[model samples]
Target chain A: MSTVEHTDRGPLSREEMAAVVARDIPDGSYVNLGIGQPTTVAAHLRPGSGVVLHTENGMLGMGPVVTGDDADPDLTNAGKQPVSELPGASYFHHADSFAMMRGGHLDVCVLGAYQVSASGDLANWHTGAPDAIPAVGGAMDLATGAKDVLVMMTLFAKDGSPKLVPACTYPLTGVGCVSRVYTEVALFDVSGDDVVVLETWGESVAELVDRLQLRIARATRPRGPGRLR
Target chain B: MSRTQFHTAAGGTTAAEAADAALSASGVASGMTVLVGGFGMAGMPVALVDALIRHGADELTVVSNNAGNGDTGLAALLAAGRVRKVICSFPRQSDSWVFDGLYRAGRLELEVVPQGTLAERMRAAGAGIGGFFCPTGAGTLLAEGKETRVIDGREHVLEMPLRGDVALIGAHRADRAGNLVYRKTARNFGPVMATAAATTVVQVGGVVEVGALDPEAVVTPAIYVDHVVDLRSTSGEEHAA
Candidate 1:
């Protein structure tokens, strides 16, 4: 397979980016939506699709976010955000929840990324900042044990540095765990061969590279011999 | 001696010395009931647990919130088939094999309790409360065999205090006086079970001089703690498993 690069015209809206990422998810998949941008996927799941959501605090079959008047104070996600339960939902011991993650029972785990290496290494937990709390909190277990890992984040840090780099500097959650990447600039796949950019938001490859002010090598051809669509 | 006095004898040892001393003093004959504290993999008394397993204490009843994760924690005892009965709040899917196989074959006795009620039951025993009432499990399978009562037109299930012959706990630090403090999630269920057992043994990462712990931070008072065992300071080589 070869890397595929597409162009980006301008800054795409968050909804537009979410719609693109949501299209990759298949029906009837069990997924763990990591805190932050990945959590938005739950709000955009395809209707009538049997996507079973798993939370680490022992609730299965989670529904979309609950709005005002329907929210219960006791019902919350792992991050303590109020959530609704889907039909046929059940609660088990918290240990059972970790077991499912560690035993490779989850089909997909969509996680927010601080930095992802070319070889699919994930480093999202800690930044070694002096004020940051050092809690791993099941991220290592989910990253390593989940069947397929998807990273969702912006392409660059707030300081305008590339997050997809040659190697990660922070503590890695797992080695070679990330399979796909969804960024504000473009959607990319980190395969065994190279970083293949799938689609850009209306910008040419040369223009997008110039806009980001990075000298990244462009893919000569699309990976897998053709475009995904 | 009364069971309370029997605990005082066990509590006299330092945390590092508690494991071997408890093992030697208890005369823990095979096939006995053992209650340990810790939620999930945290707060497990690794040193004491290792001693029990090494001592080949078999056919035991283990009462805890969880049977640890695989390769560590209480699950090791279950993997060894040393546990005959598990009274816990939840079992992880990875460690479900032990519960599933033994429970299905009638070889293991499994009892599930509501998480909040289980914590309260332990706390009640520690506090000298004979029994407490709650509506958590009423009208469910958990109500079966449990005493039921109605007060003010509200149904409540009576859950008796749970006390064991031995209680194992984990601590972040302990003083020579037996005052204990747990770090983060490791604090779950440890302080409660400390008082609910005939003999309460604590495993601490560090054993400090008396008065080393702040007076305000001691979660489990020295009065209720009997023994303190120091965990082996391995270079990450010896873990819960």
Candidate 2:
């Protein structure tokens, strides 16, 4: 796959972005989709993929949203949205469910972020607003416990500032936890103090570099056949 | 060396009579700590909380998952000016305005815990554990002033077990022996809380005879339950004739 776009091709829609993340999920993975935008990934999972969906509210093998007679009031997610239980689904107490999370049993956790440092520091829970209630539910545990921490968010804030920052300004969730980021503008493979541009949309490499206000490490393309190193 | 023995009988004139006996024996007084089981509205003991409201105790400390929602159940108790503090995970969901109002007014104290950490602390209390180290809130504000150590090169924080004077829980069915089974996800925190408190009182949907429940299906065994108030059997005809 080409990891760079030299020309400006534009941004992907929300549905397309969700589908892109869904396509990357491997079969037989246990994943926790965070509240808000990350929850949308549940509807896009490939059929019969053997991927188990887990909710932090003591449910594993959770199904997509249900309505009417199929909805069970007692079977809701952490977000308090009504959901259905798939076949082979199991329920446990709150502590055991959290053990499945903080004990490193989850394979992947997709979360929404307000800012992510180049070195993978995450800050999504609060913005330091004085009046905000500051409820940090399970974001910290999921970020640190999941094997692969994937962040899903928009590329920029509503005021047109970069979310991929030199360092997070808000309270940090976990240090060096995030490895990959899926945004509307592009997909990024982030490592120690560097963001590797794996894909681009609606912006050229140079433009993205300037917009991000941080260092962008471009993955070099392979040389043509018969060409020397 | 022997397993825990069961205490408490299915003898009362009415469901309300059973509830009154349980509430009185719970020794619920001003400034006592209570543990209630529920996630949002599910697994909440509505009638038991109502009886506590009528018991007229003030300055109570409540420990649960959420504070309250939409002015019912636990929220009603909070609205009645009976609660002085709340130890919970999510205290400000959309429907929990009762707590918000009291908290803003400096009447109710709010101590917010991480969801997983809260659950584990309660579990540790029930399992006879003193305390345990968890990796949930190592670098966050929740770890402030707490003991932290790195195990396996990862930071972990120590949290103490939480206990209460009384734990009020809801179950779908309970045999006269007090073996309880819950309905679906409503079983969220009921089983753990039942074992962690000094006394556990259950509000059940229905009552059944001994040996009616499958031996393998019992969730909270009879030893943990101190009393049961059957909501559906007020007339006592099912147990009689």
lDDT string, candidate 1, A84-183, tens digits: 8788876543344655775678888889888988888888766767543234445665776577888888888989888987788886766677888778
TM-score, chain A, candidate 2? 0.92
lDDT of 2 by residue, B1-241 (tens): 2132222324445555566667877778888888998888778787788778888888999999889899888999999999998998878788889888888788888877888888888889988999998877677777889999999998899999999888988888888788989877788889989998988888887778889999799999988988777766545443210
RMSD of each: 18.5, 4.6
Candidate closest to the true structure, highest DockQ: 2
Q: lDDT per model, in order?
A: 0.67, 0.81
Chain B TM-score list for all models: 0.84, 0.90
Query: Which 10-residue window of candidate 2 chain A scores lowest in summed lDDT?
Result: A220-229
The recovered share of true contacts, given per candidate in order, is 0.00, 0.58
Q: Pick the candidate with the highest TM-score.
A: 2
Highest lDDT scorer: 2
